[model samples]
Each structure stands twice: as C-alpha cells, then as structure tokens.
Target: MLLEGERDTILKTTSAVLAEHGARREKLIPLLQAVQEQLGYLPKLAMEEIAAALDIPAVEVFGPATFYNSFRLHPPGEHQFKVCMGTACYMIGGQIALDSFERRLQIKPGETTADRRFSLDQVACVGCCSLAPVVVVDNFVEGKVTPTRVDGLILSYESNGQKVEQDSQQTEATNTDEAKGEEGS
Candidate 1:
C-alpha cells in the first residue's frame, strides 16, 4: 500500500524522469535507473507511472525490474548490512555471523529492522573470498567477524547513532537561539 504523500512524490518524480528521457520505450532501462536513483528504490507506484508514460503494460516494467538485482522494490534502511555467503566465507563461519545478526536485529535476510534503522541481506559473494566470514556494514567490509564482534559492532552503531542525533538537536537549538537573538536586535 502506498502512503498518499509518498505516492504523489513517486508519481511526480517518475513523470519527470520519463520526460527527461523523451518518453521513448528504448529509454526504459535509463528511466528506471533514474527513478531508483532519486527514490533510493523503485516504488510500485513509480513503476506503474513509468509503464504508463512509456505506453507499456505494468508487467513489462515489473518483469525487468524484478530481473535486475540492483533494482529494489522497497526502500532501503538507513544502514544496510550485507553478509557474504561465498564458499570461503561459509566455510569460515559466515553463517554464524549472519545468525548472530538475525538474532540481534530480530530481522531475517531481505528484511529491515522494526525501527527501520537497519536492513540485512545475504550476497552470494562479495568478491573478497579471502575475507572469509566477512560482513559488509554500509559498504565497509569487516573481515573475520565473529558472534562476539557482532555484538560490539551493533552496540557501537547504536551508540554512535544516538550521539549524532543528540548533536543534531543541539545544533538546531543553537541555531534557533541565534536567530531569535538577531530578530530581537
């Protein structure tokens, strides 16, 4: 189901992308890519709009969308964790790392956290087979990640996230105060 405001944004953005590509069916791939780049994922409504703009069936849009591994149907979480399940990684306890994350985050692969803070996904390979039992957090690969290390990593992310939020709030308050002072002057 699409939220009203998000749906409107998706429709508008998709339309603009189609226009930029001259609304040509040959530009379908680029059209989809542009929409995904803007929205972080391909929302269903956006896909439908793209099909309509190209005068194609929604299934045609959906088929290619699903076929491309890079196109995500759902919005990505603020933090994405990709676990490598390659032969070396699996042999070296990558499964343990994945299980630890599932337990700690309380979400399985291809799912986001309840708080919408994190998402977990498993990849066939990260191309770093040498880094067996590797976990890539936000794009930084952590090699030889153990269950205990997972705990520390989660704690650090949570703590750092909180600190950043607090800092942002403080900065906003300071800015507001300065603005009020200037207005009074």
Candidate 2:
C-alpha cells in the first residue's frame, strides 16, 4: 500500500530537495527514497508518478530502481530480514547461515516469499561487527548466530507470532539510548 500521511511529507521533502538541486537529474537517491516511503516499494506506477512530478522521463526513474540492489520493485515482505556479511560476520560462517536460510525458505536472497511473510537480503556491513554472523529480522538483530541457530529463530517466530528474538529488542534499546545520548550531547 502506498503510505498516505507520510507520502505528502515525503513529496514536500522531495520537492524541496529538487528545488535545492535545481531539478538536476543527479538527485535521484532522495527522489527514490520519497517514492519508496510512499509506496512501501517502488511500484512501477511510481516511475510514472515520479517522472511526472519531477519533470523527468519515466525511464530516468525506472533505471535506478533496476540499477540499485537496495531498491524494491514489489511490495516488501511483512518482515524484512537482513543478514550481515561484513568481514567479521563472514569469518564466523555467515555464508553458511545464509545458505541455511535459503535452503529452508526455498527462496534465494533478494527475493520475497510467496506469502510475503519474509524477505531476505544481505548487507555488506551493519556496523555491528562485534555481533559477528548476525541476522536482523524486521528490526531485531540476532548476534553471534550459528547455522544451527536458524531453525530456532524460525520456530521462535512461528511459535510466538514472530517477535521471538529477545536479543534484537536489547540492541534496539541500546540504539535508542545512544540516540538519546547524542541528543543530550
């Protein structure tokens, strides 16, 4: 679904961003983010919407969505899963864990399940290298994950309505604290 309330704000922001860049075609990133924020994913229709709004060609907008790994063409899964493959995570068998997920899910990375319950992708780094071999489901990050841990994560969510990983909550708390600290500083 295209997000409505925030879509206007995003539109305003994109328009302002365009005004700042003097409507140059180079400001595509922010434009794309605005469209993504509105549509949840970049609907093919969004290319037309953005092109008309920005006075650019639809191809101009579509090209980047195809070009960037981060862009989404379809509605994202209800839960987005991100695996970190940073040097530290990889050394700790991150690839093995990812393979386990793919095998079990029967869908490759960068693809969403038919039910849209889960979508998986990889990140080069999430800056949580200390938590080597990590996977983040939705917003919850699982640290120090082993290949053996995959089923537990799946079952934990399946059994508990998908909010199973306690570690992710703790990391989110830490992030909030840091955000507060930054504001105070």
Candidate 3:
C-alpha cells in the first residue's frame, strides 16, 4: 500500500485524468495507463477512486485493466523472469525450462514468488531462435539455458544486482571452478 501522500498524488493525477474524460468510455485506457505509470500496478483502491470520481462503475474500470496484459492487478515482483515458449523454444526444451522454474519457485507461470522478489511468466518468442532454449531474467536474455542455469539466474537476481559483465565473469569463474573440482575428483 502506498503512503497517504503518495496515494494522494496518484489520486490527484488519476482524478484529473478522469475529469478530462467527459464521460468517454475510451478514455479509460489512457487514464488507467496514467495511473499505472505512476504506480507499477493498479491498486484496487485506485479503481474505486476512479469509479467514484469518474461516475463510472468499478467493474467498468477493472474490465480494461484486466483485459490488458501489461496491466498488473497485483504488485509485480522486483525481478521479472520470462521464458520463450515458441515452437523453436519448445522443441529445444522450453517446457523443461518452465518446469525448472515451477519446481524452484513453487508457482505456476504468470505468478510471482511469495516474497514479491521474482515474477515468472512465459512468452511465445524472445526473437532469439539460435538460442532456442532461452530464458530472460530481468531483461538479460540467456541462451541455451540448462536447468542448472536457472539456479544461477535466480542466484544472480537474489544477490545484489549483477551487471552483464559481472555475469560473464561469474560464468567464467564457475566454469573454472567446475574444471578444478572435476580434476580434484
């Protein structure tokens, strides 16, 4: 929940937006978009506020928000994870990647962790076919991901934010460590 002042700010902005609608139903999209832009996701309270100010039904406000894929009814996770499930990705084990996440997260696709730290979702394609088994974690599209790679991905996100360069370095270090461990064994 937002603090009073923050909620006021959102309400002020959204109310002004709704005021300009002049009873046009189409205006709902942009109004919702504006409020969502201010807040990452639309709160139920915001819908009620909008309904009251606009003289519209709360159900009317919810319909468009629910219809749009970008509109998040609940607060989104801090880190977003998406796996490509396109034809190519599927043939190369996208389902397996999805399973890896379900097992680790204990949540199905389109759900978030209880801690609100990670959100999991699926997309038809990430547009990187060469990397058929692709997983995108916080906008870093990883290719040829194995199940173990999911753990590493989660680790990176759970840890302090790691940059792409840091990821490369860590991958190298991990490979080297694995080689050493194998040699020792």
Candidate 4:
C-alpha cells in the first residue's frame, strides 16, 4: 500500500504525463514509458490512473506493464544482482549461483530485499558464453560464479556499506571538532 503522500504524488505525475500523451490507445506504451521514466517504477495507483486516462480497463494497462521485462512494478534496490541463465551458463551452474543469491539475500529473482539493499534478477544471457555461469553485480560481471563466490561477494558489499557509514561518522566528528576550535579562537 502506498502512503498518502506517495499516492498523491503518483496521481499528480500521472496526470501530467497523460496531458502530454493524450488519451490515444496507440500512445499506451509511450505513455507508460514516460511515467516510468519520471517515477523510476510504475506504482499500482499510477497504472490505475493511466488506465482511467486512456479509458481502458486497469487490466489492459497491466497487460503491457507485466508483458515487458523492461518495465518494473516495484522500486529497485541499491545493488542489482543479475545472474545469467543462458544455455552455457545453465550447463555450467547458473541456477546454483542464483540459488545462492536468493538464499543469502532472502529474496527471490525479480524481488528486492525488505531493506532495499539488494535486488536479484535472472537474465537470459550476459553474452559471455566463454565465461559461463556469470553474475553481474552492479554492472560488473563476474565469470564462473559459484555459491561460495556469491557469499564472498555479498560479504564484500556489506562490509563496504559499513565502511562508508563509519567514514561518514568520522567526517562528522572531525567537522564538529573543527567547529569547536573555531569558536574558541
């Protein structure tokens, strides 16, 4: 369910997009694209608003939205994990790598984590048959990905997040000390 503020924002943005695209059935795809571009993903309320504007059933809008793999229904996470499931990858052990990610992240493919830290997806291929069983982490491809490698990858990212937090806290403390020194001077 969307918060009241989020619902209102979606409604307003959908309204503006409808005004630009008009109520033409031919413009359905482009209209949806425009709305997604603005909002990053299509919320349920935004889709309903779009359907009403086009004078079509909500299911009609949902058909194309769900049909296209490019369209996302939910917001993505900070990190994206794309596991290749092509013939070569599958033969090599892509499924196992994908299973590892699902287990560690506690979210299945096409789903983001509850904390919004990671989103997992399985793609048909990453065009690296030579490097079968590949996993793409935040656009960086890792070849020959195994279950153990997946665990290490997740740990590295988690550690990096903690390091960033600690760095920011240290910077804040330094700024506070400098401010105190200036006040004394």
Candidate 5:
C-alpha cells in the first residue's frame, strides 16, 4: 500500500503521462514505460488510473505489467544486489553467496530491506560465465563471489558511518576470521 504522499505523487505523475501519451490503447506499453521511468515503479493506483484513461479494464493494464520482466510493481531500494543463478554461477557457489546475503540482510530475493536501503534479487544469468558465481551490486558485477566475501561486501557498505548492529558485530568478527582462513587456503 502506498502512503498518502506517495499515492498523490503517483496520481499526478500518471496524469501527466496520460496527457502526454493521449490515452491511446496502442500506446499502452510506452505509456507504462514512461510512467515507470518517472516514478521508478508502477503503483497499483496508477495502473487503475491508466486503465480508466484507456477505457480498458484494470486487468488489461495489469496483464502486460505482470507479464513483462522489465516492469517492477514495487519500488526498489537505494541499493540493489542481483545475484546471478546461471548454470556456471550456480555450479560455482552462487546459491551460497545468495544465502549469505539473505542471512546478513534478513530479506529474501525480490524483497527490499525495511529501511529501504537495500534490495535483493536473483537473475537467471548475466552472460558473464567466465566470472561465475557473480553478484551484481548496484550495476557493478562482482565476480568470484563467496559467503565470506558477501559479509565483506555488506560490511564495506555499512562502514560508511552507519554503525553495525550490536548482534551482527560478533558475526562480523567470525566472518572476518573465516575470510582470513579462506585467503590463506
């Protein structure tokens, strides 16, 4: 559900987009794209408004929205982590790396952190097979990812003035030691 302010913004943006696109049925995909480009995601109310403007059912708007992978119904967080689960990556501990991120961030794939700082996702492939077990952090591909490396990555981001939670401090220490061990091997 969107807050009052967010709902108002969505409505206004959707209205502007509709005005520009002229509510034509043939312009559905382009209109959706324009709205998403402005708002970052398509809100439910915006879709309904689009349906009404186009003289179509809400399901008509929703069908293509849900069908397209490029469309995101939920707003993304400030940071995005897209873990590749391609054949090569999966064979080389990609799932382990994803599990590590989930444990550290306390959020599963396709979900964003409560603070809206981070979002996690799993992609089928990124076409970087040579760099198997890859994790894409905010559009930068991180190759050769591992569970210990996941901890280090999170810590690197959290170290930017945000204090680590008390409970995670011990886990960080343990992970640091484990990273050292892995480096020596």
Candidate 6:
C-alpha cells in the first residue's frame, strides 16, 4: 500500500520512464533501473504497473528484477554496513569480522534489522586493500576492524552517538601505526 503521493509519483515516473524507453524486450533492464532509481525499491504495485505498460506478463517483469543483484525489492534501512571480502581482507580475517557483525547485529548479510535502523551486506571489495578487513559504515571506510571493534561501532550508532566517525579516524591511525610496526618487525 503506497501513500497517495508515493503512488502518484511512482505511477507518473514509471509511465514517463516506460514512454522514454518504449515497449521493447531489450529495454527491460533499463526500464527496471529507472523505476528503481525513482522509487528506491520495486513496490508490487509499481511492478504490475510496469508490466501493463510494457505489454509483458508480470512474471516477465519480475524475472529480471529478481535476477539482478543491483535491484532491491525492499527499501533500505537508515544505515548500511558493507564488509569487504577482498583477498587481502579475507586473508586478514574478513570472515571473522563478518561473522562478528552478524552475531552482534543478529541479522545475516543482505538483511536489515527489525528496527529498520541498520542493514548489512558483504561486498567483493571496497578497494581499500591497505585496510584489510575493512567495513564501510554509512560510506566511511573503517580499517583493521576486529570483532570487538564491530560491537563498539554498532553501539556508537545507537543512542545518538557519533563515535563511529571519531573511531574511523582513530582506526586509520592505529592501522597505520600497526603497519609500521609490522614493517619494523
């Protein structure tokens, strides 16, 4: 059930996007992208509307949406946590860090918290190889993150705290110092 304004906006935008792309089978992916970008996630009503617009079956419309990793069926939470599982990070205990986040948050990857506060996901990499076991919290890259640090990070977001921001800076500095120590060793 969409709010009146939301229903109107989605209908208008989906129609405009469909009109711009036309009713071609080849244009399906682009059509889905446009609708998701405008609506945040694909609502059932919007999907049905898109199917009707494109003269395709509803299953045809849903098939690609579910197949693509980029599209989200539900709205995202306020905060998004993406853990990088690159080779360097994984060798340095990325899996453990991910497990820690899952255990602490009580939600597995690709799931949002029941309170709608946080969402967790595992990415192939955040491109911060130096920051092995990196976790991107709301777009801030945290390096050398351990299981203990994951707890503190979640707590910071709770109760209106900004420690996560402060902690990211400290973690970067700490990681740098640790790297120097390893080189000296």
User: What does candidate 4's lDDT look like per residue over 3-103, in tens digits?
Assistant: 44878789889999999888788999998899899987888888888888878899999999999999988767788889999999999999999999999
Give candidate 4 regions above 4 Å deviation.
1-5, 162-185
On TM-score, the leading prediction is: 4
TM-score of 5: 0.76
Q: Give, for candidate 1, the lowest lDDT window spanning 10 residues.
A: 161-170
TM-score of each: 0.71, 0.63, 0.77, 0.77, 0.76, 0.75
Per-residue lDDT, model 4, residue 127, is 91
lDDT of each: 0.81, 0.72, 0.79, 0.83, 0.85, 0.82
Model 2, span 39-68: residue lDDT tens: 566666655656776788889888889898
lDDT (Cα) of model 3 = 0.79
What is the C-alpha lDDT profile of model 6 across 161-183, one tens digit per residue?
Answer: 57577865665677689899999
lDDT of 2 at 90: 90
Q: Over 4 Å off in model 3, which ranges?
A: 1-6, 20-24, 106-108, 111-116, 175-185
RMSD of 2: 11.6
* Off by more than 4 A, model 1: 1-5, 106-108, 124-130, 159-185
Q: Name the candidate, 3 or 4, with the larger lDDT value.
A: 4
Better of 2 and 3 by TM-score: 3
Positional deviation of residue 49's Cα in model 6 after best superposition, in angstroms = 2.2
Candidate 3 lDDT over residue span 46-135, tens digit each: 788877766888998888788888887766678888989999999999999999988988877767787788888888887999998988
How many steric overlaps are in each model, in order?
0, 0, 0, 0, 0, 0
Of the pair 4 and 5, which is ahead by lDDT?
Answer: 5
- In model 1, what is the error at residue 57, expressed in angstroms? 2.9
Candidate 2 wrong stretches, greater than 4 Å: 1-31, 48-60, 166-185
Task: Show the lowest summed lDDT stretch of 10 residues, model 6.
Answer: 163-172
The TM-score, computed over Cα atoms with residue i paired to residue i, of candidate 4 is 0.77
Question: Which regions of candidate 6 deviate over 4 angstroms?
Answer: 1-9, 161-163, 167-185
